[model samples]
Target chain A: MALLQVTDLKTHFFGRRGVTKAVDGISFDLERGEILGIVGESGSGKSVASLSIMRLVDHPGRVVGGSVHFEGRDLLKLGREEMRTLRGRRMSMVFQEPGTSMNPVLKVGFQIAEAIRSHERVSNQEARERTMDLMELVGIPDAKRRIDQYPHQFSGGMLQRLMIAMGLALSPSLIIADEPVTALDVTIQAQILDLLRDLRDTTDAAVLLITHDMGVVAETCDRVIVMYLGKIVEEAPVAELFDHPKHPYTQGLLGSIPKIDEKQEWLAAIPGTIPNPLEVPTGCRFSNRCPQVMDVCHHVSPELQVVGPGHRVACHLYGETGTVDADA
Target chain B: MPDAVMETRHLVKQFPVEGSRDVVHAVSGVDLIVLRGETLGLVGESGCGKTTMGRLVLRLIEPTAGEVLIEGRDLGALSKRELRRVRSELQIIFQNPFASLNPRMSVEEILRRPMEIHLRISAAERSRRVGLLLEQVGLREEHRNRFPHEFSGGQRQRIAIARALAVEPKFLVLDEPTSALDVSVQAQILNLLKRLQRDLGLTYLFISHDLSAVRHMSDRIAVMYLGKVVETSASETLFNDPQHPYTKALVSAIPVTNPRLRRERVRLTGDIPSPIHLPKGCAFHTRCPFVMDRCRTEGPVLQETGGSASHLVESHLVSCHLVDPA
Candidate 1:
């Protein structure tokens, strides 16, 4: 069985205008010890989907449909108290911005120890020890000295390491990291990615990584789910997706990035901007910007079909009898 | 082939830490040039002083020691009144577009302030200019009346660009202009910058931590480590053949989207040294993979390699004593 299965999950924000289908009927599964990357541009609902899984989606947002099953237990149907118990223990989330995620007044040690004290019945001494150990594990130098200092004393990269320490403190089964290294420099990003891979190897926990960078996905993830306008347009393994991306949106996203090796005149971006969630286009959501869009795509929405082993795409071009091997 | 629109000689900026005798060596002993109609990328990690260097070029923040020559005039020698006059020729677009824009003012009012302050244009003429600028940035005339909060992030940045162009500045300091936008929006903004430069003949000093975006946007690139330019070369040459170890590590660390060509990742050990108490020799020698014995004692100066006066690197350009000790 999959470690976590999100089935037809639909998260929407109810506003004065209408319901913004942020995570509209998306379904995917994460296996244990696997890094599943969700790649998309901003407002593509990648962050919202991760937030929905953690049950951390704020007000004006609600999971309108679908079930989230973790270890064969329904996460969406859990009661308030039960869910709270599961949050810091069974699962954890690391937000994108470490500067904002941490409290200004509190010391880094206290904040990290609070996470320990939230789930475990331990003394302050034990909590402090665990926090230091976690800090050291995340590669923070002089963990003992830095533990007493406030979050502001640490640099941006150091602050991100602190967040990782807190997230890994409980030995959770899964971690949802939203743009974990986006704020970091390239070398720092590489270090954090290595740390994440190390954590997964040692802890036996899965990760659902969400980022706008396809380069990151190519480097770290085992599988990738391409999201556009709050929907998954393509899902495939990392190597396969890079080798033979089927969806036009995915292709555009890949082609638009300037590789360090290749010289090009232009990075071909998708012609139009992403449609506002309030004014989502009917039929195929990407039809407006799809370079290979057909007339039939304007009136018909395509369902995700398995075109190869462990590869799926939702496009009209591959209507019923499209069987392209992604690994080719 | 083109004249250097802006050049700095030994640019230095030191900030006094509050309640401390020691000062933060924010930007120390830097030299750079921005060519006419060329986008020069200044890339580094946070606290590496890329932003400070950009500000020094615009003279927004006064440089403690150095000569910032813009179009043949030394900015350091200029008086307050003269600097104000020069300010109209050089402008800056900040990293956070939302924070940079005035929340209380509409887009039209924001655009109008720059023109009113510097250009002395009539009210009727200001309105027309603002409308034309909005249309130029791909925004409709209807958007001028709306507040910044009403527009998307990409639109807000376009407005910021319009405000920067209000004075018809020939030189622009774009500090991470596209870093705040999404990927697709980043492409749009970069394309817009390229197009605007070609059309308006604008020179740019683009500062960013995103190397990939910087590589895409810049004509020449400078890799900055703590408070200094480690390497400077043409964009293609720098990307293809990085001379400095820091530049090589930076380029190597950039995750390529293609999986077929997976390069071995070289993880740079140790964090960036504190700018307050920098290393004895090279600031990056603490973390550099190719550190020599002399690197820990004496500083290296930026020198030309391969008889090419354009490509400058602080470290030994090719094989050093640390590598091939023949």
Candidate 2:
């Protein structure tokens, strides 16, 4: 069985203006020890989907309908106490900003130990030893000395590592990293990504990596789900998605990136910005900005359908035809 | 060779720490020359002094030492009134458009303020120029009446650009101007910048951490380490054949879009050392993969690599013990 399965998840923000369907009807499955990437821009609901799975949506936002099945148990159906026990024990999250995520006053080592002790009844000494081990594992040099230092003392990269160590303190079965390396430098980003890859190889934890960068998705993820305006527009294996993106949105995103090897006079940028969530389009959310917008696309939404082996795209162009040659 | 529109000779800036004698060596002995009508890309991680160098060139923050020469005139030696006159030729567009632009002022007012102060233009002329500037940056005249908060990230950036170009400046220091925008929007802004450069004959010092964007915009590129320029070369050569160890790691670290083109990345270990207590040798020696015995004690100086001198302005220079002797 898949380690985690999300089906028809709907998360909405109830504001004075209107309901903002942040994560509107998204579904995917994460295999054990797999790195699944969720790629989207700011309002595409990629972050909200991950937050929905973890049941971390605050007031004014609620998960209206969904099933988050983790290890064969529906997480949404669980009570408050049961859900609290699951968080940071079997499932953990790493956010983008490490500076604000950590408490300013506490030492990083103490925070890791607290996470470990919250779930397990281990003694102070055991937790402390395990914390040091985690810090060392995440490539923190002079772990013994640096363990006592507060989050303010650590650089952005180092703080991110501390956050990763905290997430791994309990050996969680699943990890959801939301733009884990976005705030870091490229060189430092490479290092953090390497550590994540190593962890995947060594441990049984599945990673649900959420990011806006297609390059990061290509390098780190095994499978990718492209989100647009709170919906999953395309899903495919990493190589297949990059090689032949069927959805126009995905194609635009891939084309927009300035590749390190190739130089072009003009990047084929998408025409418009992402639509405001409260004022999302009626039929297909991307119909307004899509290059090949059809009359039908403005009236009816497309459904995610298998177009090739382990590849799925939601677009009117491929609705009737199972596998239309997108390039041709 | 094209004339050096802006030149920095060993420009340095040091900030004294609070309640301590220690000083943060933010920008140390950086030598750079920006040729006319060319973009010199300055790239580094945060706290590597890319922004500080940009600010130093414009005299936004007073440099502790060295000279910023613009068109053969030393800005430091200029009188107060002369410095004011020189400021019209040099302008900067900051990274955050939202914060940099005043929320209270309308778009026209913001763009007009520079013209009113620098150009001393009449009210009617300022309005006409504001419309023209808006049109140039791909914004409509209607946007001029609205406040900055009403515009999107891209549109706000357009306004910022319009303001910078209002003074008819010969040079611009674009400090991560597009980093905050979305990928698609970033492309638009980049394209706009390039178009404006061609149309107006503007020289740019494009400061950004995004290497790909830098490569796209720069004629020549300079890779900076902790408070120093580690390498300088033509854009194509720098990307294709990075000579410095730091540059090599930076080039390899860019995550490629295609999964099939998986290049082996040179993973530099550890965080960048703090500027207050930089390593004795090379600032990057602590994290460098090719650290040697001599690299532990002696620092390297920027030296010209073996290449034809057809383009003296674009010659490749690297600062590494392994590449060239100090």
Query: What DockQ values do the models have?
Result: 0.61, 0.79
lDDT by residue (A34-95, candidate 2, tens digit) is 99999999899999999999999998999999799999999999999999989898999999
**TM-score of chain A, all candidates:** 0.96, 0.96
Fnat per candidate, as a fraction, reads 0.66, 0.76
- Stretches of model 2 off by over 4 angstroms after superposition: A320-328
Residue-pair clashes per candidate: 0, 0
Model 1 misplaced regions, further than 4 Å: A100-114, A117-133, A144-150, A320-328, B103-132, B141-147, B308-326
Per-residue accuracy of model 2 over B159-274 as CA lDDT, tens digit each: 99999999999999999999999887898899899999998999999999999999999999999999999999999999999999899999999998988877788778777888
Alpha carbon lDDT of each predicted model? 0.86, 0.91
lDDT of 1 by residue, B127-157 (tens): 9999999987888999888999988888889
- DockQ winner among the candidates? 2
What share of the reference contacts is kept in model 1?
0.66
> Model 2's CAPRI class?
medium
Please, what is the TM-score per model?
Answer: 0.90, 0.97
lDDT for residue B116 in candidate 1, whole number 0-100: 89
